[model samples]
Target: MKTAMLNKYFNTPHESGLGKTLYQFNGLLVLTFFILTFLVWGGTGYSAGIMLLLSPLALFVKDRPLQITKEHYLIILAFSLMFVAHASAIYRGNSAAEITDLDQPMRFILIIPIFLYLKKVGFNQTWFWLGIYLAGLICGWQSIAYTAGEYGTRVSGPFNPIIWGDIGLVFCLVIGVKIHHLIKNKPQTLIPKYIELSTAAISLIAASIGVILSGSRGAWLTVILLALLFLTIAFVTLPKRISLAFTSVMIICSVLAYAYIPTVNVRINQVINELSSFELTSSNRSSTGLRLQMWYTSIIAFQESPIIGLGKSGLTELEKRLVNEDKINNWVVTESSQQHSDLFDMLAKSGALGVLILIFFYYSTMKAGSALIPPYSSTIVMTTLAYIGFGLTNTIFIGMNGTMFFLVFTVFTIVAGEREVTSK
Candidate 1:
């Protein structure tokens, strides 16, 4: 019965209103995202993503009364909580700069309507993943250039490798889905298995190399952790032969990377050295040290006003505290002022309420795509987890790049999973 309703909602064509325009506009939004994601950089792409929200806005407000429904309520509620947090901060007289943080989660404002529209008309993962794949390929090309030039650290063309790593991780997941389909002989491709497999393999290899080349230890750790979890799941539930093959392939890849990739070796060694040299008291003065200092001060800020924390003012307060503690060197304050970690950024900036909304936002989004099936599910879930992991060591929600990537996928994922209860 439920499937029948879903079928009808999805299959029925728009005969009146701007439904057709709005529906087609959805595809255009994705196409724009793809084009911009691959070819563009800086604030422009993220800005365009935010601007793309206007298409749906016009649909809801311009042509007809906005259709509010139970189907959209989850997304609505999730987004509303984010707004409430931002609004609450502003109502109480927070810095206007604090509002910029809203761009992070606020990027998903159209999930509800977009999901409904997509459910009605359906979307093709083929096109979606293709966009993602092409974007990753661009990153791969730049990575080769970066390495060939002997550029130290990681390989990111224009953006931070952390952000680049985020892109690569999603592409690799897309490759996983594509490869699975190829293996299933899904008849989606006319190309021979060897050719298809080779392309997919190159893409995967390139994406993984790009991630490692970015030298984002955080991303590297997250990918490794995810791999272990996936392997365990495969071994426990998947066919024995398949599991064995996967395990063997993963082991080979890891071994080869660790042995052959100089950057990989350097990063691992750096992690070891950093951990070994870490000191809490008075700070150690390194990349890891900076994070520790920032984290400690953020905790202090959170403790000071657990209910309604310091907001951007916390940065000032943090500086004062660090100054008083004699930890306020030029560098320490420089990094701390930026709120390097998303955990503290949320805690210190919006306090506990911000954190709650954040939790709700991610939870709802992961489940938002609950209506999407199979490979689509994999993409959404992995992307969410990757962002969460990246957020741990970096201010993922603070940066435009990180937030923009998150926004694109969260909306995509929810729409893919959309299960709107339509007319009977």
Candidate 2:
């Protein structure tokens, strides 16, 4: 009876009650962390996220900390390849300017405290799901607010629509899981079920609209892939009727978004045009053509130093080579140095070995996140899939938002969900 009472209301980090209060209140700390992570706008989220680590650090100091294991070291080593790839390039005289960019990814190490804290006390799924709901809600509103404006095709908040759309895609997966869970569990409470079911519906509709309005082709592609993945997983484990219904809903959602949303059609037209009339010469540099044109340089740079590639700062050499060959547009060369695609960027900066490390890291992340309950494992896999799809066309690691999203969630899964069930 005493133990039950204690477990209900108290979280004792140490034997004495002196530090129990702090540990008891750690849930609030975790709530704050999740809030910061989900609200990836401006620099505020990242800043607050880093500061929130103090709570866990304090608890870890007061309570018994986790012992470092070989698995943990290996995971860290996999992550190390990310930073080391850049350093190796710099070592090989890639670019001295990469220092500023290097610092951005280093902040991803904050995932350590985040993982440790959540691992000790488990994550607040209620709050986390709520954040996902709110994100979808906000992005949906933003889409409506931006529609009919000049930027209607790329409806967004502070960040680009691509980021907004990609995150919304992940939220859609969350929404899908929530809806599935509600139905799968056969909730008995009519009132609660209706309320939750309504919330889930609204979240899905809004996130779907947000994705369409954002006009992010990468996100659009991933949405289709994730939807198919969800359906396939369901088909294997769920009733045939349920799987068929899910498949129908996904198809309907895509069709409605494409047909009713003006931005979706616009993006499709742009893609069609870009592909149909792609020209690699300096005379024309379409969006698709520009990406291809830039890729020309990346391919050349990779071939030259296929081992590690051109190093971190190898862009200088690449641009110079582009000028000599005249294979790339002067406009693209002058406008941005980014290869745009993460695949090519990895090849250009780190070479084939870096790409292999990245592939292994992603595979390991999914491996660690496998076999957890609904929304946990599925969420990890689907979100990872979204990023992978997005990375094919964009530079995910070069930016702060993508880097944080990937590391924080990946670490959380490995330490908490994948390694063990939530510690009671």
For each candidate, the alpha-carbon lDDT, in order, equals: 0.64, 0.66
- Candidate 1: give the clashing pairs: 369-417, 371-417, 372-417
TM-score for every candidate vs. truth?
0.78, 0.82
Best by TM-score: 2
Cα lDDT tens digits, model 1, 127-167, are 45555666666667777776532337567466777677776
Evaluated at residue 367, the lDDT of candidate 2 is 61
Q: Write the per-residue lDDT of candidate 2 for residues 1-424, one digit (tens) a residue.
A: 6675345444343443434444445444434544453344643245336435554554644444454555565556667677777556555673355456556656545555555554554432444555566666766877678654444557745566777677777778768877887888876332368887898889888888778777888888876676777788999999999899988888887788678877887888888988888766655756777788767777888888887888656665676667667666676666444677888887887789878877876776666557555557767777777888888888777776667667765654444344333222
Instruction: Please give the lDDT score at residue 265 for candidate 1.
Output: 83
Lowest summed lDDT window (length 10), candidate 1: 59-68
Residue 11 miss distance in model 2 (angstroms): 7.3
Question: What's model 2's TM-score?
Answer: 0.82
Residue pairs in clash, model 2: 94-313, 95-313
- Which candidate leads in lDDT? 2
